[model samples]
Target: MGTVRPNVLIILVDDMGYSDIGCYGGEIGTPNLDSLAAGGVRLTNFYNTARCSPSRASLLTGLHPHQTGVAELVNNDGPGGYPGSLSLRCATLAESFRAAGYHTHLTGKWHLSNEREQPADTWPTRRGFDRFWGTISGAGSYFQPTTLHDGETPVPLSDLGPDFYYTDEIGTRAAAAIREATTPFFGYVAFTAPHWPLHAKDSDLAETRGLFDEGWDVLRTRRRQRQLEAGICSDDATLDHRDPAVPAWEDEPEQKWQLERMEAYAAQVRAMDRAVGTILAALEETGQRENTIVVFLSDNGGCAEELRSDPEGADQFRRHHLIIPPTAPDGTPMKVGNSPGISPGTADTYTSYGQAWANLSNTPFRRYKRWVHEGGIATPLIVSWPAGGLTGDVIHAPHQLTDIAPTLLEATGVPALAERDGEPVPALPGASMLGLLRGGEPVEHDLFWEHIGNAAIRSGDWKLVREYEGPWELYDLSADRSESNDLSAQHPDRVQDLADRWQRWADAVGVIPYGDVLAARATMPTQPA
Candidate 1:
């Protein structure tokens, strides 16, 4: 039930937006997360690496994704930093804790390895985790996921049982892991909820019905106002315009289907929140609540990649990614993508809450996932450490995902790993933010980011970012968290300085220009299919 050392629980969700939880100004019901935030520290300006695998890689290793061989998703894009598998050259949080005698467990979403066909060292079990439960692929059906695994072994669909739901199972497994721990534990609950394939339970969906019928326009503004009232964003921060590609809600043709998609999305988040409650209950039941440090954050901003709107949704899913399952566990045809007339939130149909809803999830931020804009990188970080003796508060200082590893290691009294097998592990780009979390004045330093070709560097309050092949833009994040006003034209000198700094950091971390990385992928030898 308890141990001498502190317990650590990190719950990382996928493709969730910056303000999609109630504590962060979202309308979605997340009482569990809200309770944690109400009694913990909620950060106003936190960031992820702008994509899934890369963000996970950085959070695990305390290094940039490029240095950890996860520059992009789970495929080798090119030489420099494009090896899409998590390189063993780095030290993972689990590895660090396991070496220090902590028992580690993972339940849900392990997309770090490129080896989906077979187990490899890149997998969590081989990388110092004591137990693992989750999928090895990026995204798939929630009813019947692809590359499902229990520890190092593959899980057959038949064995998943009739009442199986990935989110529920993940939460149950995580609670059990925590409750049964004999030693100080490190449990990573990486739920694939609120990501693409908007599948939800019927009961959960019923609760979300009519919740999003008002459409994205109204919801987006309401979320922003709540954010300001809650002190989740700076007072000066203002909502940016809606995404140019999205039409006014009233003008959209498929209103019914749009609401259904969001209903599914909200249901997924609500279920995930329930799981968080379960995890917390296990800690309390075991008397570990005061000693456990629980941190929750999303991997990236809400996704904008609209799924197909045609009848052949499954075909589109197949073409989009071979890894996505083609059929359900019962051998019935599984419909994928968000097509008209097909209600989402069912096991037979997989869909997405597209750009409009995604924009609402991200609230006032600009841009969507895969870009280096605020909407793509910003995340709401809620940290709860009752042992630290806080009633509840908010931390307005900015921080990035990479800071998590070092902070946990420091809080748990584990030394940072310097090398792996005498080869020096790549120096981490992040520092411990534990002091800031525990009521110390925040320190400022340059923060850098790059994914695909989009790149950025944040120095003090100023930030410089650019899309692949696009001109550089600058913003003063202290005043403009939404990134509405472009300061690049007026601050040419600052732009050049930040650009130079970004380039140096990129080269140091093995980042190649996006164009070059893709070009190399094109010429690489075909795999033996």
Candidate 2:
């Protein structure tokens, strides 16, 4: 065997946007992440699945979500393609790494399986993680989360103390795992920070208390300007007009409360960043910093979903049961939503930053999460492998979440398996990005995305995309990264060809018909509100 492989750390944040990190042109303080970017390569055109579970499935299995049986969120429905859980036909990166003699550890949000049944076979431990510490579902109150688990068993809420913040616990546990591992390790630090419920520590929230008081309109312009100056976007890139559904900043009622909402979101991100710093520091203390490949990216773009004032209604919308009448440490009732007089950033609150702030989070992009637009799928992909000799470079090659597993496998010199447990595994649809990181010729491939009825296809600099039941829109992404101009009518043949290609790929991947998935969801038994 060759020399021992380098350690691998994959940091995935929930519901973060393309421009939310300091290195990616946002004003958020992310010194550790920015330092990684400065010392490594940043991919300007990397993409995610535009939703949480789907992105996680694709990233882990090295296959499209539909191919891994997670075409939709984590609730098995519809056909085999929409099983809503990681399938046996594909192997996870952790599984592969463990077979190659590396210790595997996963901490934080593991939404790859259905949480309602709590099936042990589908949990992270059975899926090949040696150690697992996280919530099975997607989003929840950070303070007192539901379905928290360790390895194969559920962790009791009584075991957690007042200082048990989800993001901090994730970092702490992952760092501990790294320290204890005797062999090269593959650690996944999946943080559910800044997703929803808008919770944060008072000290962290205080850091951004009056930061967003100017509102999203000013912040959006400022982020776009910074993006241009930092070469994150081209000088000729045009910022897309704000979504019509979002009211102008000046026209919004409850201005102070809205500002408070954004400040709370910023604080959540800052807290996650601090946790990242802690893990990186741990790696350095262990003398593993130089050999470890540290990657940081968000699962998807910023979320625009609003938190309902009714706890039951919110729980139903979130597709999970939440602890009703959530309370802070002081035992005060949590008030949820954008209603005036109720502030966020406390355990006594459940709220989201809303669409206007999500628009600002995505900066110059066109739409929010759940759509197939740039705003929905674009993510900041920072890869830091100091021993690999990568330094302060920007790679504009378009890559998908499916590429992550293959890239890591290649970087660690692990061979991909053709089968597992006598069952043939699906081949990875993405190519390794090592060459691109090392300043080699760009890897070119057509990429396709489908969520619900929304879909997009990118071939070279041209992209063809559409909303649910909407007309196809085309853009030359090289010049219009914001997707402001529709060139579909100007290039009807290209549109037809790209759409045809996407349809073929979708069919091959066993993607359930968009309408079928919707019908199945509609027919499911509704939870009582």
Candidate 3:
């Protein structure tokens, strides 16, 4: 007479491009993910907030990052972990599920805050997760990661063994969590693959050695064409060119290093996919396969962060910006250049593939992560729910990360609790996608995003986006998914109207002023009026 409540699994991959998966039209071999797509709904227009911590914060809290006080990456110094930490005011998705009688578990990158070293109440244990086994840092040596935690305890990952890969380790733990979970579980398995410090097993790395020899241009063009064929974008959408930082492949001094860099990245993704397969197998073994609702997505678009070499160097860059080489008058480094031969796949390097490669990574999309453009913020969302609950149809509605929490709550019949410890938390800000999932009318709503004063507002088919240093750009996303045609000059009134709406959202949420919010917090205590 009633629908069966299913277990929930939210798998978020780090720095994965929208077109990287095989289903999304990339060279990457991902059979496990492809199977999920075939059996479920492939969402083409879902978007993230365009960064790691912000997307994660909004996804968990159902509110924008500014409202949760994690507008950027949380650091130890910032209040409520402004740059990279979670705030106390926010109630996480895990909390909601736990309150609803689900056993909550989390593994992989816990970039929320490094409260593990601080106090018991500030750690993941206090953040609503009943069981936690993961790292507290953002990106680090995959071999012996720092801040690797078992609940609140700082434990060496070596305990897991030497040959253990971080991606596989996380996946194995996630599978075990499911098998051992006594009640319906909420498992948030975040894999930090394809991030920085690209390290893959020798076998995994060897498989992709000759893969990128085709070079960035060829790979990017091929991927873009595949995306077009898949109806992921408007046919007329032009492929966005590479970033200025990325040097042309022909100009690269060492093609071998470039090829190896990408090879390692691909291997990392492959390992993650394999791990997903393991978890899926566990779901079936536990008899929760068909009824379980599994949603897989990337945290943001392809990441283009320039990783540093070595924990010391990365720490130096993080603390004092000392690792960045000094530049001459012409903006070229006097001594140290952004050169290869730092030996990628080692523990000492922190280099991104640069914008040229990132351009290829995002394929037909306009920009990479951090911008509000299609390439940067857009991501592939695959939902797998059997038992005939969700229609196996592709829905192209523009969904934001905030909608994830509400969708989960509605699907699992979990209600958002108003109070935690007698204090009222923020209400859910996202609408449930249950209607769309059940093949009902298309859900329509305006989505907003603001990070470091770069703002965007998408209302229906029309989207208005503005970066801190650029002019306002308007696009009818229904017509121009590539964002090649800027209608800012053509439609002045509509631009103003969207701009006003963006400001209204910024004011409604607590979007910080452009620049370092931590710096503002530092000066507030002592500065005289």
Candidate 4:
């Protein structure tokens, strides 16, 4: 008889940065995640797809986002790559594990399907998970989210009590799934905390009340120092300059409101950490800790979108057709943006930390989410498996989000199938990290990323990247991981080589031309949900 497989628990958070958790250099309280890092392995150079839907798609299937039919967000825009849904040609990690007799359960965001009306075919339950609970959209009100689902059925916010919190609910559902499992389980806890609409509990808010008074400039410098001390980055890695667009923190007039916004953001992060502790405790209580593989990572870097009502650009920013007005549970008006009067952390308010703070959250990395920069793509990856012999160590090898599915399969002894449902699926593009986890030599492979028109390709230590409609930039990531230095002019031949490699990969994966997608998106009435 074969030995029983180890349980797999993947905890994914939305819109968090490379260094928000304690283990990754942030001051936020994340003892549970820190403990995981202390006992397991931390991948310093891990990467993601730089956006929500694409990152989720890559992580779920061991294929690039374009190959998985989600090149962009959940909007059927250009062609085969941007189908706005998980393609039939792919098999999700949950599906593969469930077929191997592992009980698969998913709790939290499910943004894979574009047709929410007919979610039965693409929802978690139909996609190999035995059970499912969470939102179907990418972002929404934490208090009263739209399109909340429980195994293909719509779960109204009214069904939940006044004290209900989305992050807590995800953790609770994940714990319940872990406890009820009769067989080795594959549990996915996707928390939407610290994303946007910055609504956190009063207690959580109180804990971080004075935390951000020092402002983003100081916070950024402090985090960079901490990151260096923690060995999260190389000793010689220089901190990227503060974004030229963001004003100096000292010159900011709305200090009080700005501080409060950061406090709310930190509160959201802390609350998410607390939820992780709850799930970890449940793992211990259920006696699944020793043989369970717990993997925790963020979907993307900190978001910088200002989803608020701006009076200066009333025609543009305040357009009801463009922006959906956020509302509280009782239908009370919830104002969003950098408005001074409207303090965040309440259900009656919706706001983001803004670009300055997001820059701080990313700490030493350039740009924010959506761009093909280190800040947009880098993520802290924590993998803990006591039975797998993974110990406290930092692996600096560059690994993409797509590598996660194959890693889990290998760890749990589940075989990757060449075909599923009688269709020949594309071969897994990601290599398993099992060898690295066992303290073996790091694996070498080319890494690729594209969202909208922004694109990048990493071959060995050299990275060639370009923004939408922008010129190509090259950097030796081994020395300049922050991408501060553009070495394109110095290495024209290398630039052409990497660019050629990216073009071939893009074409092979059926990635629609960026210009075509952008033109199509311009004609569309709706903005990303």
Candidate 3 lands at a TM-score of 0.91
Instruction: Write model 2 residue lDDT over 1-529, tens digit each, in one string.
Output: 2365889999999999999889888887888889889889998899998999899998888999988888768776644226676887789998898998889999998888864336656678888799988888778878888778887677876788988888888888888998998999999999998798789888888888888777788888888888888788888878886788988889988898888888899999998998998899889999899899998999889999887766686555444354333455567755766566668878777788888889989988979899989999999999998887664588888999988888899989987778888999988889888888877888889999999889999999999999989999999999899899999999999999999999999889988878887777676654211
RMSD of 4: 2.2
Model 3: per-residue lDDT, tens digit, 6-53? Answer: 788999988888888988888988999999988998888899988887
After TM-score superposition, what is the CA distance of residue 98 in candidate 2 from its true location, in Å? 0.5
lDDT for residue 408 in candidate 1, whole number 0-100: 91
Please write out the lDDT profile of model 4 over residues 190-297, one tens digit for every residue: 888889878889989889988878778888888888888888998687788688898888999899988888889888898888889889999999888989999999
The TM-score values for the models, in the order shown, are 0.96, 0.96, 0.91, 0.96
> What would the TM-score be for candidate 4 when compared with the true structure?
0.96
**All candidates in order of lDDT, best leading:** 1, 2, 4, 3
Candidate 4 regions exceeding 4 Å error are 78-81, 311-326, 522-528
lDDT of 1 at 126: 87
lDDT score, candidate 2, position 455: 96
The most accurate candidate by lDDT is: 1
Q: Which ten contiguous residues of candidate 4 have the minimum total lDDT?
A: 314-323
Error of model 1, residue 107, in angstroms:
0.7
